[model samples]
Structures are given as C-alpha cells and as structure tokens.
Target: MDIKTAAALHRLRLASIPEALSFPALLIFGTGFRIAFDYDALVMPLGMLHGVLFVIYVVLLLDVWNRTKWPVKRVAFFFLLAILPFGGLYGDKVLKREEAAGVAAAQAREEGTVDA
Candidate 1:
C-alpha cells in the first residue's frame, strides 16, 4: 500500500481505540449511576456519548476494513468487540498487533528484503 493509505489506516486505528474503550466505560458508569444513586438523568447524557462514540467506532472500523482488506469474519469480530464490555481494549490490542506487522512488512519491502 502507498504511504498515504497506510497513514490513513493508522489514524483510523488510533482514533478507534478511545471510542472503543470509552463506550464501555460510559455504559458501566451510566448503569451504576442509575442503579446505585437513582440518577437516571445521567443515563441520557452517557447514552448519547456512547452513541456518538459507537458511531465513530463503526465508521473507523469500516474505513479500516476497506483499507486493510480484512476478511468478513475479522471485520465482524471487531464489530462484535465494539458492543461487548471491555471489548474495545481487546480490539486495541489486536489492532496494535496488526499495525506492528504491517509496519514490519512495509519496512521489509522498503529494504528490498521482500517483494511486493
């Protein structure tokens, strides 16, 4: 892939991490606030925050999928991870691994150690 495309994918991957992690944290905090303190008002704002983050996460995921040409199963797995609690953290780890591998491959190509 070209440098521009690789850079875009890397940005998308980085952008996804916080949204993925925040959504779950908000969900937990929202639920806890509602149940423990009867602060139902907290849910509305938290839900909205989560909803926006979820949308961003999905958009980034789709962008990454298109750029990376990931398999359907892999894309679906990442989508599923978005909805599960703490799944974003796991997704971040996976993305980091993929990023490292992609960088290594790109370096190899640049060094003429591997043919495209």
Candidate 2:
C-alpha cells in the first residue's frame, strides 16, 4: 500500500475512536431509559438517536475495516465491543493505541524510514 492509503487508514482509525465510545453509550442509555420509564416522549427520541448513531457507527466501522484490511478476529472483536455494555471504553483505548502506532508507521513510511 502507498502513503495515501496508509494516511487514510490513520484518519479512519482516529475518527473511529470517538464513535466507538459514543455509539455504545447511547445504546445503553436508550435501552435503560426505555426500560426504566417507558416514556414515549423520551423513548421515541432516544430510539431515533440510536438509529442514527448505529448507522454512523456501522458505516465507520465497515469503512475502517475495509480500508485498512483488518483481520477477521480484530473486526469481530470490534463488532462484539459494539454490543457489550461499557465495551466502548475499552475499545476507545485500544483504538487510540492503534491510531498512535498506525500514524507513526504511516509517517515513517512517508519518510522512507519504513518499508511500504
């Protein structure tokens, strides 16, 4: 892969970190809110918010996976994280570390200090 692809992967990975955190939090809050109160006024809006966040999260996840060619296990792990309660926090940390490494490597490659 070229620097362009590597750079893109860096960007995608960085962008995904926040979504990894926010999406699951929203899911949990919405689910809990619905169960605890069942208020149509709040639940309805929560559902809509969840739907939008879910779509964005999935799109970002798939795009990062496809663009970076992450392995099945890694992708599957992230998919799992999307569901498990509080998983996004861990996922956020993991992605942050990954982003650091990937960005560093991408920079190195661009500088001809690492193999392309």
Candidate 3:
C-alpha cells in the first residue's frame, strides 16, 4: 500500500483499538459495579457507552480492512483481539509494525533504493 493509504489505515486501526478495548473493560466494570454497589446509575450509562463504542469499533474495523486489504488471517486476528482483554494493545503493536514497514517501502521506492 502507498504511505498515505497505510498511514490512514494505521490511524483507523489504532483509533479503533482503544474503543474496542474500552467497551469490554467498561462493560465488565459496569456490570460488576452495579452488582457490587447496587447502584442503577453505574449500569445504564456504561451499557450505553459500550454499545456505542462497539458499533464504532466494528465500523472502523471494516473501514480499515477495506482500505488496507489485509490478509484474512490478519484481519481475523485483529477482530479477535478486540474481544480479548489486552488484545487491543497487542494488535496495535502489530498494526504499527505493519504500517512502519509499508511506510519504509514507500520511502525506499521514492528514493530509488529498493532492495530488489
């Protein structure tokens, strides 16, 4: 992919990761807090936020996949990562590395310094 495309995809990928992570974590916390504290206040707002963020994450994921044309394996892993705790951070690292490599290749082509 070109650097611009890669960069844009990377931003979308990175932005989505946090929303994905937060939704689950907050859901767990909100559920637990509602049970433990017996406060109705904690449950409703967090539930709403989680639902909204979840939708945003899905939309952002689709956008990145469409733009990046990532292999199925990579895309699947990325989606899986969103659900598992700490997965978003790990996925971000992977995406960053991929983005950096793509950017480097584009730079090399521009400089007439391609290895091949």
Candidate 4:
C-alpha cells in the first residue's frame, strides 16, 4: 500500500488495540472493586466499546495485511498481539519503526540515491 494509507491504517491499528484492551482491563478492575468493596455499578458500556474497537482492529489488520503484502506469520502476530494486554504497545512500536523505514526508502527512491 501507499505510505499515506499505510500510515492511516497504522494509526487506526494503534488506537483500536489500546481501546479494546482497556475495556477488558477496566472490567476486571471494576469487578475486583465490586467484589472486594461492594461498589458495583456498570461497566457494560466500556465492554461494548472495547468489543467494537476489537472488531475494527481486526478489519483494519486485514486491510493492512492486504495492502502491505505482509507474510502470514507477520499478520498472525499482529492479530495475536491485540488479544494480549501489552502486545499492542509492542506492535505499535514495531509498526512505527517499519513505517518510518518504508517512508525513508520511498524518499530514497524518489531522490534516486538508494543503493542497489
């Protein structure tokens, strides 16, 4: 995919993962509070939002994989990361580095200064 599309997708990917992951984390924490201190109220909205963001993240991942022509392993890792709490953070950093490298290479090509 072009760098602009890639950059946009990457940003969406970053946004979705954390929001999705936070929902579950918050639920767990809230549940703990309810059980430990009898402070139950409602957390369904956060859960629903997280679920929605997770779905969007999946769709975005597919689009990114298609556009970037990523290998099956790489795509799998991307999906797997979303499921784990901290995986998204790691994936975000890696994706940013990859995207930066891609932009640099593209610039090099445009300038006709890239090494063969």
Candidate 5:
C-alpha cells in the first residue's frame, strides 16, 4: 500500500477503537434504562443517540473494508462484534494489536531491514 493508504488505515484503526467499543455500551445501557426506569422521554433521546452511534459505526466499518480490501467474511465478523455486548472491546484490542504490528513493520522498513 501507498503511504497515504497506510496513513488512512492508521486513522481508521484509531477511530474504530471508540466506535467498536461504544455500540454495545449504548445498546446495553439504552435497553436497560428503558426497562428499569421506564422513562419514555429519556428513552427517545437515548434511542436517538444509539441510532447515531450505529450509523457512525457502519460508516467507519465501510471505510475499513474499502481501505484494506479485507474479505467480506472479516468485515462481517467485525460487524457482528459491534452488536454483541462488550464485543467491541475485542475488536478494539484486535485493532490495537494490528497497529502495533504495523508500527513494527514500518520501523523495520525504515531501518532497511524489511522489503518495501
């Protein structure tokens, strides 16, 4: 990949951390809040927030797939993680590990130890 693509991927990886983690948090909290408190007024705003977050997550996931050209199965796996409770943490952890590996590879390339 080119430098620009690499940079974009880096940004997406960082961005995905919060996006991956927040969807489940929002889903769980919103449902729990509605059930326990039964406040229709608050539920509206909470639902809206959840909708917004879900949209953002979709967009970021699409960007990741587009940038990396990852297979659909892998993308679907990440999509699945978004809806599963606390699965976002696992997604975020995976991204962090990828970032670490990318950094190490880049460093190796910089030191003339890895092929370009």
Candidate 6:
C-alpha cells in the first residue's frame, strides 16, 4: 500500500479501538447500574454514547477495510469483535501486529532484503 493509504488505515484502526471498547463498557455499566440502583436516568445518556461510538466504529471499520482490502473473513471478524465485551483489546493487538509487519516490510524493501 502507498504511504497515504497505510497512514489512513492506521489512523482508522487506532480510532476504532477506543470506540469498540467504550461501546460495550457503557452498555454493561448502564445495565448494571440500572439493575443495582434502580435508576434509569443513566440509560439514555449511556445508550446515546454507546450508539455514537458504535457508529464511529462501523464507519472506521469500513474505511479501514476499504483501504486495506482485507479478506471478508477478517473484516467480519472485526465487525463481530466490535459488539463483544473487551473485544477491542483483541482488535488492538491485531492492529498493532499488522502495523508492525507493515513497518518491517517497508524497512526490508528499503534495505533491499525483501522477503517472500
């Protein structure tokens, strides 16, 4: 990938991590707080927050997928991960690994030691 596309994908990937994490966390907290405290006031605000984060996550996911041209399986994996509690941690790890690999490959090309 070109530098611009790669950079954009990286940015999207990074952005997705926090949104993915926050969505589920807010949902869990909202539910727990409602049940434990019998207070529903927090639900609407929390739900709105989660909804916005989820939309951001989906948009970023699509942007990254388009830029990276990842396999459908991988794209689906990320889509599914966004809905699961704590799945963002896993997604972050995967993104980091991919970024490292891309950097290493770029360095290797620069050094005339390309691997196949």
Per-residue CA lDDT of model 5 for 53-100, tens digit only, reads 667777877876787788999999888876775666687778667666
Note the Cα lDDT for every prediction shown. Answer: 0.78, 0.65, 0.75, 0.73, 0.69, 0.77
RMSD to the true structure for each prediction, in A, is 2.3, 3.3, 2.5, 2.9, 2.8, 2.7
**Candidate 5 has which clashing residue pairs, if any?**
none
Off by over 4 Å in 4: 20-24, 37-41
User: What is the per-residue lDDT of model 4 for residues 1-116, given as tens digits with 9 covering 90 to 100?
Assistant: 34665575567557755754675587687777778888666456656667777787888888777778889999898888888876787777787877777777767766778763
Single out the weakest 10-residue window by summed lDDT for candidate 3: 12-21
Model 2 agreement with the true structure over 66-113: per-residue lDDT tens digits: 777989899888777766555655776776676667767878887989
Backbone steric clashes in candidate 1, count: 0
- Which model is ahead, 5 or 6, in terms of TM-score? 6
lDDT preference between candidates 1 and 2, better one: 1
lDDT of 5 at 115: 92
User: If ranked by lDDT, best first, what sequence of candidates would result?
Assistant: 1, 6, 3, 4, 5, 2
Lowest summed lDDT over 10 consecutive residues: which window, candidate 5? 1-10
Q: Write the per-residue lDDT of candidate 3 for residues 1-116, one digit (tens) a residue.
A: 67777776577566666666776678789888888988778778888876786577667777778877879897788778777766777777777887888888889988888853
Model 6 bad stretches (over 4 Å): 107-116
Can you give the TM-score per candidate against the true fold?
A: 0.80, 0.70, 0.78, 0.77, 0.73, 0.78
What is the total number of backbone clashes in candidate 3? Answer: 0
Error of 6 at 113 (Å): 6.8
Error of 1 at 20 (Å): 3.8
- Give the lDDT of residue 9 in candidate 4: 58
